[model samples]
Target: MKTIYVTAIFIFMAVTVFAQGGPPATPIDGGLSFLLAAGGAYGAKKLMDRRKNK
Candidate 1:
């Protein structure tokens, strides 16, 4: 148990110490827009199918 705790602490410290790099930029415009459009189309299709059934 003590060794596990020590290892965890060491790993966390090493990660923090080594993670001082540059910027982390994630471009989410195109993929996010496509995802939103697909979700909207799926929801609209489901709603239409349900309404047609009733």
Candidate 2:
């Protein structure tokens, strides 16, 4: 469990680094939105699969 938590935190930090932009006016909204949507869709699919298995 400790290892899992550590890995999760590391992954989150890594993603934040890529999400950052150097330009003052740079926009990350588009990619961020896509990532959120994709994450939601993936969670929904996993939930559906879990239900089906049970």
Candidate 3:
């Protein structure tokens, strides 16, 4: 348990020492639209299936 705690502390310190930040960039707009369309189609199909079974 003591070794685990020591190892974790060392890793945290190393990450903090080397960490750096950069400027943000533009985000893609197509992937999310495609996912939303696919999900809607899937949900519609499931709803239709359930209604047909009733």
Candidate 4:
């Protein structure tokens, strides 16, 4: 029983540490993606409006 408890704790710690390893996301990357999406949306809306008006 004691061995099982220790093994469980070790596995939990190992998974938690490994799961979190990654390059942290840069703020600029997020901002650029958001800006691109917003610009695309705006352009699409403008194009649709022009088409509708025509």
Q: Answer with 1 or 4, whichever has the higher lDDT.
A: 1
> Candidate 2 overall Cα lDDT vs. reference?
0.97
lDDT of each: 0.97, 0.97, 0.92, 0.95
lDDT (Cα, 0-100) at 29 in candidate 2: 96
Two-way lDDT contest, 1 vs 2, winner: 1
Candidates in order, TM-scores: namely 0.57, 0.55, 0.52, 0.50
Q: Which tens-of-lDDT digit does each residue in 1-54 have in candidate 3? A: 999999999999999877856668767678888999999999999999999999
TM-score ranking from best to worst?
1, 2, 3, 4
lDDT of 4 by residue, 1-54 (tens): 999999999999999999896997667888899999999999999999999999
Candidates' RMSD to native: 9.3, 21.0, 10.5, 6.8
Model 1: per-residue lDDT, tens digit, 1-54? 999999999999999989888778989999999999999999999999999999
Stretches > 4 Å off in candidate 3: 1-26
Give the candidate number with the greatest TM-score: 1
Model 3 scores a C-alpha lDDT of 0.92
Q: Using lDDT as the measure, what is the rank order of every candidate, best first?
A: 1, 2, 4, 3
For 1-54, candidate 2 gives per-residue lDDT tens digits of 999999999999999999998767878899999999999999999999999999
Candidate achieving the largest lDDT: 1
Candidate 4 has its poorest 10 consecutive residues by lDDT at 21-30
